[model samples]
Target: MNRVDLLTRSDALARPASIAVDDVSVTYPNGFTAVRDASFELGPGTICALVGVNGSGKSTIFKAIMGFVTPSAGQVRLCGLPVDKAVSQNIVAYVPQSEDVDWNFPVLVEDVVMMGRYGHMNLFRIPSRKDRRKVDEALERVNMSAYRTRQIGELSGGQKKRVFLARALAQEGRIILLDEPFTGIDVTTESAIIDLLRELRDAGHLILVSTHNLGSVPDFCDQVVLLNRTVLAAGPTATTFTQENLERTFGGVLRNFELSGHALHEDDDARSLNVITDDERPLVFYGVKKGKKKPARDKAK
Candidate 1:
């Protein structure tokens, strides 16, 4: 190869990748189109949210990224590599929703987390000392060390979620995809999970979380990709997550409320209150009159 060509290739490799989907389209054999012209890109040191309603092709997009299903058009790339190559190299780790797992399966919690190490194991799939240590550290990080020997089916809903997260940690993948991680967990557990995700993001791990909980999106995610068969919006949360964009994405699915003046039981400062919710959690904004102040967001959701 010429010197110029070699230099160009080296420069590309030197740059860290941001997961990317370029004009991806996924059509099923049944003549149903799952995703269309959808695209988004976010690099490491970011926690992004993939927000959309059920049947909006979230799962299909995820399948495409994981190489479970190939997109009829376009492609998915992770860490500067194709999806298949990334998966094979264990550059990606997935924590599936509870519904996708068979909780009744006869497996201990530690054993389940240890499965994450299979990619790093030898052909025999036996756990080495390093693998065992990774599993133990993962469990401890998720505060599930005491439940390591317990059956997978015997834990609480939140605890089960933590175990899966532990498995992802053990895998030590740079890209983590979590599907509805907060669906059934309590507030405290959800907070803990978000904390862990933030730590991962600060450590240069890329995280993509698919969730319907709009209230929590702004808390941790700085970037967002709104999907509905195709991408409605993809950018920083501050701009892309506005009420107008969300209304376009959710349609009639969100409940919006606006209260002003006497309705708020206030002394009539003309400040208004706005609430947008999907019933799970709501985003609330308190208004300000004149130029005295800008609107303030309450984090109750």
Candidate 2:
């Protein structure tokens, strides 16, 4: 067998890690298409970023992968098993977007985080001291231990995000799917969360995050999956961030920028203004219009 075929077969037969999404697609009951013929494979000990604009099927894909939304076509597998089956076994943890959660539910932060352990505890059994200790460790991982007793409603947006993350940590799953974890948070909180995710990845967990923030993907993710109702691109950031692919994915809204000598310049300016003309192709500039030409210097004759 060829090298590629051998690798594929080996991966298929290998022990499952956290989550694996096959050719999964989702359609609403009203016949509206959300995700179309999408497929991706994620292994343990890796961080993947799902990037796209609004209504680009990022969250829809997440829902299908998590078994929250049934797929109209194809199958979603978790750790080599079907998604529905995996959910019952608590093999996956989902941290949803904060906007979808109601802050007025009147639950303490610690209680909410401790809820993650419910899957492990018997339906009617009380949490043991070990479970409580797991909860404590989870809260500590997200740096939310001090606010454990505070009401969820009293916490700031960043703190609320951390509480949800702590819940995921408490679950102790090998795979985690997060939706917009950095939304509406301060940079400090965002950085802290990123660091925590890295630590989790190091511990052999598979992490998949859907985000609109492209700036952080390169630094934080080992792979990037770009979607727009379909799999526009999927691969390493360096390979998938090409101008041709981005333009096709983002259409006319795609803008490109380049940094040189601590200054950012647009592709249009770099070309029309005659700033630099070499064999190097300029980056595509999106959104911004070409600026007016500067006045010519007076002759010294």
Q: What's each prediction's TM-score?
A: 0.90, 0.80
| Model 2 Cα RMSD, 1 decimal | 10.4
Candidate 2, 61-129: lDDT as tens digits: 888877879988888888888888778877788898988988899899989998988988987858999
Model 2's alpha-carbon lDDT is: 0.73
**Model 1 agreement with the true structure over 171-268: per-residue lDDT tens digits:** 87778899999998898999999998897777677899999988888899989999999999999887777766777998887888878888885585
In model 2, where is the ten-residue run with the lowest total lDDT?
Answer: 272-281
What stretches of model 1 exceed 4 Å from their correct place?
Answer: 1-17, 265-270, 288-301
Span of ten consecutive residues with least summed lDDT in model 1: 2-11
Best by TM-score: 1
